[model samples]
Target: MTSNDTPEPTRPVTLWAGFIIMCVGMFMAILDIQVVATSLPTIQAAIGVAPDQMSWVQTAYLIAEVIAIPLTGFLTRAMTMRWLFVVAISVFSLASLGCALSNDFTSLIFWRVIQGFSGGTLIPGVFSAVFLLFPQNRQGIATTIAGVLAVLAPTVGPIVGGWITQTYSWHWLFLINLAPGIVCAVLAVWLLPRDRADPGAVRRLDFVSLILMALALATLEIALKEAPQRGWASPLVIGLAALSLVSGLAFVRRSLTAVHPVVELKTLMNRSFAIGCVLSFVLGIGLFGSVYLMPVFLAFVRGHGPLAIGTIMLVTGLAQLATAPVAVVMERRMDARLMTAMGFGLFALGLGLSAFQTSATDFEEMLWPQILRGVAIMLCLLPPTRLALGNLPPSQVPDASGLFNLMRNLGGAIGLALIDTVIYGRAPVLGREIVARLQAGDVETAQALGIPASVFASRIGQPADAGTAALLTPLVEKLALVQAINEAWAMIALLTLVALCSVPFARAQSIASPQLQAKAGH
Candidate 1:
């Protein structure tokens, strides 16, 4: 084992406190993405960005963020976790401040890239802390704490953003990170364990590997971003995808033979860990995709504003909160594989329920599906976490954790792209079908669009005039959108089921209980 296995130990309470603070820091970073997402239109208008260019704000952040995640393991070694958290949080806070102060889109996006790169470290850092700070018995409790906040941010972000946007200005969406970030950074410095930063390790860094990895992830993120809008066959998207693939392969080859590779590629040889990563990737697809899918359907099909969409989505968040304690308890008592199966099964079922949604399906129809997904959140996370990181030696946990988290993000990018393709590609064809049916005086189609029978009664035997067609066009579009979104829901549901099938392939990993470790120490 490497020197990383034997960490600087502290009192139990202090260690838990430090970990909690790190979790909070991670929550802030994650919440920032979703919060800003819901208010992007408002921010775009305020910053004087043209509509077409606004997607860059989010794209810039995602590209920089993905490039930084795997590098966290190296940074933690170069500068110990305590100092790294301090430095990253400080930069993130300063960037947030800069974003708030920026009057133009260019300045805002510049700060966003910096913010994302720094914020990316916060996630894997906390997961690494789970193994580094706590013993195996307590790791479940720790994972639950971090996992809840990780998923909770996206669930609640829209509402928070909507409330802030509606009550105050869009600037507060970013400025909200300031106070908590400063306080977290200061506390992390004092409470977290520290080790000496290595000066010469910086010299050992392989800059070529670093550049290749960054290019690969950056180009992949951009390619995924563009593929849905410009078809995957688009020459620009193809070139970007090819570049990402080539760089990724070269980086892998270089990493395997390097004197001191940036990331530990050999970690995947562990069967449980590799399968656990697949589970994480599938979870990312469902987690981020569902969160993304709901807002789109609610906003576009139902015409709900950001606040209302957030409020409706709150059901999932509330259900998750209520079920967290139960998940923690079950974690200590059950077989992890069994828990993973149940979690993904329930999550898939939840996704499937929405597949039957009609255009008129509203609050009552959505409640149960959201609750099922919420309750499954912890189940989906804690078991796979144990299966993945619990088997690794402490020395490898940092790098292993980075790769694990990165898989989830990569899954989210790919899943969202697929969801968008389903929506954008199929909507027009479905729209045409609905239009043709409506022209034939199909009452069922009209009723599905929430148009009363009386409204179409007089026009049943006649062709619709231009005015009538114009009036019905928007309703037809909403109907088509609802159908397309339902298909997207089913698609993710199938993906989650595939995750469930992989669960049994993960062999059980043994972890010593805290009591056993204490006696051994004695």
Candidate 2:
């Protein structure tokens, strides 16, 4: 009954069952992250938190992730995967319950950080385990399935969140995690393989490297988060940036010397893997940057409500879900580099389409590009991930996957911080310029200038009844803000295109497992 290493790989029913359970866990984790975003206003009121302090819920989770990701490899080797998973899920689920029951923001944020640490376990473990479950030839398929979860979870998260937020209290968002978390934990105990941790691996932990990485990532994350509010040169911001630079350098030095490192620096030495990481960084910028920008744009510029904004993004999410199968099918035959290029290229094109938007642009106009973006994302994200780790030794898969995700997540943090700083910084200047050009009743200039003056006045800026002399000026200001945001999307598109260049260097290989061969042959 046991499918431990044998000459012929036996189908592990338990592995497939574990995959199913992990999918649910993945769904809950991603759903909570995004779903609660739309529900934040409601939660802030329910918990009586001020707007300035509300960000802690997300900050706590992200900080926890930063701390947990590098430790995953060491942890997996130190504790049996099954027991580790059980403990992680148990903590995450209980944290969810605590969140649902919490009466104040401080208490909620506390449980959220706890949830962050526990929830961090699902990704690398599920992905690495899935690779182990399938035979070698089917790794592409396994990875694809994993990719679908990656893409779909964030997409469906908001839709589910919207429905729950509208129907139940915001507490439901936190409560929802409990069911899946408990189920995933139980399944892990029942069907999952309990691979015991080797004691020899415990001695290999690079404590200094771990500290340096945590510090580097934490400082960088803090610097990025603060940039949007406190201009880049703010002393607090500048100091964190300096600390991040020093820590980043220290981590690199330690990783090279440490007998056992948190990250396998040699794996990154592969040209393809390194290049793939560059694209991943760019992909992170687009994926996460857009998630931050679009809703803000839609709500502030387009005058959409939380439900409406959620609905619009739900389209992109659905489109992404639709594209997953195609990516899965195509990766099997096509070189991953080509697929990565295609994805980035399409994403670039989609970004270009977004730049053309104005206050007059309607939902349909946005949908087409979203569809394209979704397809492009699947193309860009999956292949690079596949190529990045494909050439590494089988034993290195977990560590590589952890590093890959860590880099991408870090890229996302950078993107959000940078884009927000750029857009928010430029908005007032752009708004003033637009006002100068379009004065009210200057029909000749507005008509000849191709301004949607009426739409702008109604849709953008601080809503107000203005002086007759400046009646149409707000219209111009609104368009300018909208245009500025579009410009941001354009920047992301160009960045994604640039990321495509890295594809040429991706290594052309995949990890092999004999069990995979036996299953396929059977």
Candidate 3:
């Protein structure tokens, strides 16, 4: 475990096999988020939950997942990677079955919570393997595979979920996890390298720290979820926010002073790692914001079906896959800081271009923006990962990886809240202005809206023409929503550009490559 000692090498066959299993598990975990998202309407109908309460289907999973993310470090130390993956995948598969069979909202949320906790560890576990299991020479390729799954799952989730829901029952959405989860569990048990659990690590779990950590994250998640709907000033939202702040401070103090904290708060002291965490947060904002915004635009504004929306979104994932090999090659030879800068620059460009879109924009118009975002995302992920974990000693890799991934989810939670605030707050004002202009008989506005001159004349003295008003109301609402979405896109572009400032702060060390070492020795 000492820094000076060389860790034992993993067999290539075992290493690659274990990595593939990890990828499948990680993909399922991330995929479930968006997959269930697209199917929530159907699920709500089936379970008979009120519309307002249906949001909990997604919220419960996210809150549980966020709480479980930082616990990976402690769990890995206690259970070891091999047994942990087996147990986690098993629990996830069984929970998936439970979710599929649940008849009511309460049971579904209970199973979803279990599913989230089990799947949460799989994400950080895969990243930890990048530094823990692979030799320096193969780390780039290993990371490429893991990165693709991490980003790709969320990209294609709607497509897969939509197809499943349209073709089969909503039950199949959860049922889909069964076979893959089982396969991943078996492969992990058979191929992963065995290590003994550290009994000392198990005994050191700070129960108070665990309680505070859970309270802090859960309260924060609830506060954000309710803020957009309940008003940020509502007593419930304010109370939760205050509770989260208090619990968060308590958790930080306890973790820093505890003999063996559940999460190692000290990882933030590494300058490069800290910068990497910030970049990951900004990336999450753009990533989740775009994903959430697009579907809303298509479904509400364009009246597109789930299948059609999924089809359009697939363009982003295709572009990412096409760029993966090129990103891998760049990781081998390029300065990571420079690559990261270029990545965020392109991402910002993409978001900025989308900000100019009109209500008439379609898949054809979105092609280039999606392409730019797809290529930029891989660049965003790979370099920051190396910068954060590349030089850490083996003992710190797991703890650092957990914290790194947590920042991204935390960013997604906060980003989604902000995006909702913008949309809900701005749309009504825009709608009122449009209605007022039309009511005042602004000729330019009438012409722009394509209302016939005859119809405009006919309604001159009438009480706003009930039928015409009914037709125009929906159109005005759609136009207002489109503008609101454009504003959200602009905000994301600004965030992505802001991420560029942190690139230079990353450590300049190249990832270790055996060939480079050999050449230097010669």
User: What local lDDT score does residue 249 receive in model 3, on the 0 to 100 scale?
Assistant: 99
Instruction: Give model 3 RMSD, 1 decimal.
Output: 2.5
Best by TM-score: 1
- The deviation in Å at residue 516 for candidate 1 is 3.1
lDDT of 2 by residue, 12-131 (tens): 676677667776675566667888777787889888899887877888888887678656666766675666678888888999999999998778989998988777766776666655
**Structure candidate 3, residue pairs in collision:** none
| lDDT-based ranking | 1, 3, 2
TM-score of 2: 0.90
Best by lDDT: 1
What does each candidate score in C-alpha RMSD?
A: 1.9, 4.4, 2.5
Give the candidate order by descending TM-score: 1, 3, 2
Separately for all candidates shown, the number of backbone clashes (residues 3 or more apart, or on different chains) is 0, 4, 0
Q: Which model is ahead, 1 or 2, in terms of TM-score?
A: 1
